[model samples]
Target chain A: MKRYNEKDTVEMRQVYADTLLELATLDPKVVVLEADLSSAITTTKIKNQLKDRYVNVGIMEAEMIGAAAGLAVAGFKPFIHTFANFATRRVYDQVFLSLAYAKLDAVILGSDAGVTAEHNGGTHMPFEDLSLMRIIPEVTVYEASDATMLAALLKQGYKQPGLTYIRTIRKQAITLYDTSELFETGSKTLRKGTDAAILASGIMVAEALAAAEELAAQDIDVSVVDMYQIKPIDEDAVMEAAETGAIVTAENHNVIGGLGSAVAEVLAEKKPTKMYRIGIREKFGQVGTADWLKQDYGLTKIDIVKAVKHLCSE
Target chain B: MAVHQVKDLSLFAQEIRYYTLKQFVTMGFGHYGGSLSVVETLAVLYGKHLNSTPENKTDPERDYFVLSKGHAGPALYATLFLRGFIAKEWLQTLNQNNTRLPSHPDRNLTPGVDMTTGSLGQGISAATGIALGNRLARRDNWTYVIVGDGELNEGQVWEAVQMASHNKLDHLMVFVDDNKMQLDGPTKDISEPHDYVEKFKSFGCYSKRVDGKSTEAIDQAIEWGKKNKGKPTVIVLDTIKGQGVHVIEAMSNNHHLRPDEETTKKIMRECEALGERIGVST
Candidate 1:
């Protein structure tokens, strides 16, 4: 249950592997299916420990998803893993049909979310996975902001039915919460304030929290909420944030149809909140380090803080 | 009760045709083309093969049937009704509001429906999954999935095909209703994956092509599929669109056409004649 240290920077994938290994021991129905990226996602430990429960289905992502569905049908809780790009973009039809369309109790672990696959560049970086998955009728999309929730999401994922997409960033990330943090399938409101609210997800949650701290220094109080769960997004938390005057949405994902779009949709329907979105503008990421890509996409804490001020001023 | 003779198999196909026609008449409109083409295959499975109970519909040990080309739900529903898995009166409520029998077969909603499917190229994957699951569970149940020749155009179908072959899902049998025609004329005109036999064989599957309308041929293919040890079977059914209904048989647009009153009367007459021709009483 202890996902990350209080101030440690650990990849979400480590938590995923730990949770997967734990599930293999506790739940007989738990199975892991990967598409030739077991080594990349750091699930080798899980594969070694739970060999019978894990299946390396070659580089066939679509087949891997189908096999996962098969495992689910056989009364096994199957967690499928691949890069975010391969998991979502390559096998969209499989995810849509074999998993979500059939309403199978399957979890798809999409690692290296957004521009996190930095050196791999545009081909591997999935900018619109959340957007594509959230529109499905029965899919629950979760992107872990840090290691703390990755383990929690994996545990919660097996208990929940239907198709679940867990977007995990593989690189070391700034840990936001202690291991005792109560994380669920829906969004978790991390910080609370009244002057203005900053909604964020994935790695941007750390930036949002840092931005909140900086804003407090400037005498501008800002609330930060971690909208980790994209679909079945914490509507109450979003509505409450809108009630706090201004809202600024930030994410490492694309500006369109990602966390920002999901929150904007909720706000557009309810009380219209004056909000600005801080994410990748309709563009592909270039080859660089994960940190460089995050900065190049204007997903740093400074960007979040600037967006918070702009939305509050407007 | 033992190995069904050719006459009995032919009669069973007629029964399938009769029930399918009746269901379509009840639904007003349905995918008549694909359903009619797969009637013999369904008849052979239900009549000569599949160890299922109409009474104990949820018997976990029973063989499973998944219609990959799920637009043909009317056909499967009709077959299930005739098998006594569902009440005949329920067939009349097809596609109605709050009807369990929607345009597609929903297992959660309907009795004897193994999987919920309507999206093309998906049911096969579920069926493949079911077969794999059964194997994992050490269950003796075999899964049969029917895919349309046109539906094979979907890349996901190939994905399932590859997985099925790779897993050596010998208990799984996939039947392709190679009726040649799709919603847009012919399958070749749309997307051509020529030589499904060779394609499946190359993919490490035991592949065979049989006259889908011939009940005896379909039964033999099913038997062969069942006997195959290390590979799954892909039985390509060479069938005709609008097979049993004469009026629809003549019209190319029968894929979505609902029989008018006059045509319905003619359909009844033709169905009766066809029933007699196949040596079966409706």
Candidate 2:
């Protein structure tokens, strides 16, 4: 097995633009909307390529969401793009009422997810987008772990036929899946073991795999899964992981209601296994690189390793 | 193909207002003032300008209506009920338990309701979305949205205003229910930025001012708006808090009212007297 450093990565933003252009090519109804950040993946590229598919709704995020819903009503598969901060918290009501409650076909792309906001600091970081989007009934909330997952989710989002929120990181994503593989909305297990199961989403999937590999070197067995879809969480996979009787959930979000809460919701009723969450412990993010932010917030592979070990011991 | 005559539209306006009051009375209290203010506008749009019928509820090319001032749902429900999109039986069920009609318009629950809008300032943006979608599809569809003057205070409304104009949603017509009143009191007291006509124009909209109480004026303004090309039109409908009913219009606060027996009877008396004088033979 080979360990990945910074070099083995692709920009999720460029992958997003290409995936969106592919979707637009496949279905002319696929349209993208951005709030002044036309340079972001789905906005400028789609505008340049499709001619009439990209809409720059200026800096108005709520209008971007509502207009996306309106586009949904008019038979266009609309994808709205903005930072996760404005995408979830600022325009939440529009997403809730105009998109979800109305049953519209729209994809909300909240980029620069979680601690990846980096130099943009706490105001730009969105650790609670998953929580807010999941509360809306039947909305498909997903976090793309790498370029491959980002590309897959972008295609699925175009034809989801309901409100979907896709959280993406703009910068580095350590490569996880081959470009040839196809994906749908569910969890995927990359590694298996008998001792403990590690559930992770978004950036934490890579971290979980790293933690599992480290544990394997010490003769400790642990499984890693990419819980990509958070709303309709893969319950069967969670149950399978629970058979190990110890679980560790990791994500780049608040431990209170992010992927931790989602996994807890499943295990609390179905399996009731010993669980630990490796994520930001109720703390807002600050300016730092993804690596520094991971260490600062205790979301590194080391943290996942510690949590899984603790769960196994208990 | 004779046009739906002016007297017929005027009569429909009276019917909309009457049913609006009846529903409010049944619900014991509701947002009646704004509902009353937009009846004539609704009558004109639904009766004359719209290409929708009960037989063609899902007609893709038909004009769409969005109630941005969604507390005025009773008026719209009345118009839709009278227009046969809803059964007359659901007329009295306006905010009752398990009723088909909710306080705000929901496209999922109600037929002929183009967009679900309760949260204010969002429906206008939905209309912009619909207009933009139609533009992208190169389809001949129109969206008529009614927004409150008070709703314009919300910054989100301005965002849609900017975007709709920037995209040149020429088929989107917005009616600013300039009812001068909000929940607290006069809009001037709550948020004092008037002259919506100038505001929409400055936002690059084809803007005009119309007397909202008059069906003919609103109808004519809509006609003029369709002819003015390359921009969305905003009809800043100059209206009192309550129109057509002297008693309601005279109330110190009618935005949402809990009319005591005396006030309710007085409203009924005034409404009937005015209806009779105007030959609205109810």
Candidate 3:
């Protein structure tokens, strides 16, 4: 059993900045492009350290994606950063035609995923970013769960080709893995049980683990799997969890076209199972604290626990 | 420039215009206005200025060209054919099923196209990035781009203009195909594009306006842009919507025309006359 840590480690934004700086230091081809969000993502270090290779496009997300495509054409690996909504919804056409349709190689880190936008409210929140990225042909999409996973995916996305989109929260995340852990597989099984399985991603992974712990005391053991990569999702992991007969999916996004929908699609085609999805159901975000918004949107561990209990009874 | 060189370039421009009309005739309908508007600029660049060739186009240090106004792909394809980058037979396959030459420029499909562009306002930003990348590598490669006057309505173009000027992309030369028209109507009626020279000058470029039909004036502006360093250059091409052909140029709605039988015959006659003047048979 992989034990979950209650302690909060480094912030995901700092890890992203440090990893990018390290990558740019070693390889001259690595370049960083920010749409005037260096302070937001803690990448001012990169701006200061690698001044020659860093580009601040100044609040223009469309130009940022286009510039990244050109840099990729010139044989330079570009890592673009912006808010999740700006990265996808604001410049969907640019990302689709210039980067994905043109078959260019670049990595995009879309921070402030979903309710993590907090007081920035509905306009900044991106509930459909994963959905938007998945529809683009051959685009790799991942939602980073913790600091370790965020760092690992950033390193991996650097070597991987084509368009890679990593959705993450910029704040501190709960410690999930050690420095020695490698994330070659898109998913990981942290807990095992027989009654049902809880598949989750992003901020919901921690809630799913807590929900499983609560369900154990109620004499219903549930498996918990962390499904980080939404596109090219780990089907083997999904199938293995299906052996439990009943499944529950939790996410920080809308129930449509996200983690829940991805798992359900695999199950409906390969092996049909009784499943329940716990997420925001067609609602926009509002100005509130992260904890208040998560609770208001039914994204806490209690909702996951209730969902699993309902599935087990049915 | 030598008189013989000017005559050769003029002949090359005529040949490009001939091939452009032939592609539209093959397709039966296409962007006749914008495609014909940029033929002379394409001739001057491919014939005299650009260091890119069929042999060295893949080289990182070679000069690059991006068709920001990508509806004019036929003109670029015709220019590439004349430069030996593509075969003459491919000109007939424009917009055909699974053809390499799509209605818009695609870098992966076309051998000589350096950037894939169709959606307006993106190619200029990409061109800026290419110029910045070459400068980062310490390569003296120049990056050239052609943007439509109407395409400037996209805010991304101004964003790229600000970026190129801020970065001091001295090797980047942008040519505005100021044809005074877009798909709907005249650009002035659609959106008041006041003065391109003043607009580009305010955006921190070494801006100039010239007769787009005069290849010699365009050649001189490019030479002057190369000499003026520490910022990007913008050459505003004063051209007609359907240049080089009187019948098409006279049409009010020549942006994308599906010619009638009589009009098609007139266009073919113009192509024949241009081909004869360039010492080629149509």
Local distance difference test values of all predictions, in order: 0.81, 0.86, 0.91
TM-score of chain B of 2: 0.94
Tell me the tens digit of each residue's lDDT in model 3 across B10-105.
888998999999999999999999999999999899888888888888999899899999999999999999888899999999999999999999
How does chain A of every candidate compare to the true chain A by TM-score?
0.94, 0.96, 0.98
- All candidates' chain B TM-scores are 0.92, 0.94, 0.97
When 1 and 2 are scored with lDDT, the better candidate is: 2
For candidate 1 chain A, the 10 contiguous residues with the lowest summed lDDT are A1-10
RMSD of 3: 1.9
Candidate 3 lDDT over A1-314, as tens digits, reads 45575655688999999999989999999999999999999888668788779999898899999989888888899999999999999999999999999899899999998899999999898888988898898999999999888889998899998999999999987777778878988998888999999999998888888888889999999999989999899999999999999999998888898899999999999999999988889898787888999999999999988888888888
Please report the TM-score between candidate 2 and the true structure. Answer: 0.96
Report the C-alpha lDDT of model 1 over B1-282, residue by residue, as the tens digit.
132333476776777788777777766778888889888888888776877666545666677788889888888887788677789888888888899888888777788887777878778877777787777668877888899998989877887888788888899999999989999888887887689999999999999899888888998888888889989999999999988666887886767877789888887787788667756676
Model 2's alpha-carbon lDDT is: 0.86
Interface RMSD of 1: 2.3
Off by over 4 Å in 1: A1-10, B1-7, B54-56, B189-193, B259-262, B274-282
Off by over 4 Å in 3: B1-7
Who is ahead in TM-score, 1 or 3?
Answer: 3
DockQ leaderboard ranking: 2, 3, 1
Q: For this target, which candidate reaches the highest TM-score against the unseen true structure?
A: 3
Give the 10-residue window scoring lowest on summed lDDT in candidate 2 chain B. B1-10
lDDT of 2 by residue, B22-128 (tens): 78877888887899999999999888887777766686667778999888999999888878899978988988999989999999999998899999999999999
The TM-scores of all predictions, comma-separated, are 0.91, 0.96, 0.98
> Which regions of candidate 2 fall more than 4 Å away from where they truly are?
A1-9, B1-7, B270-282
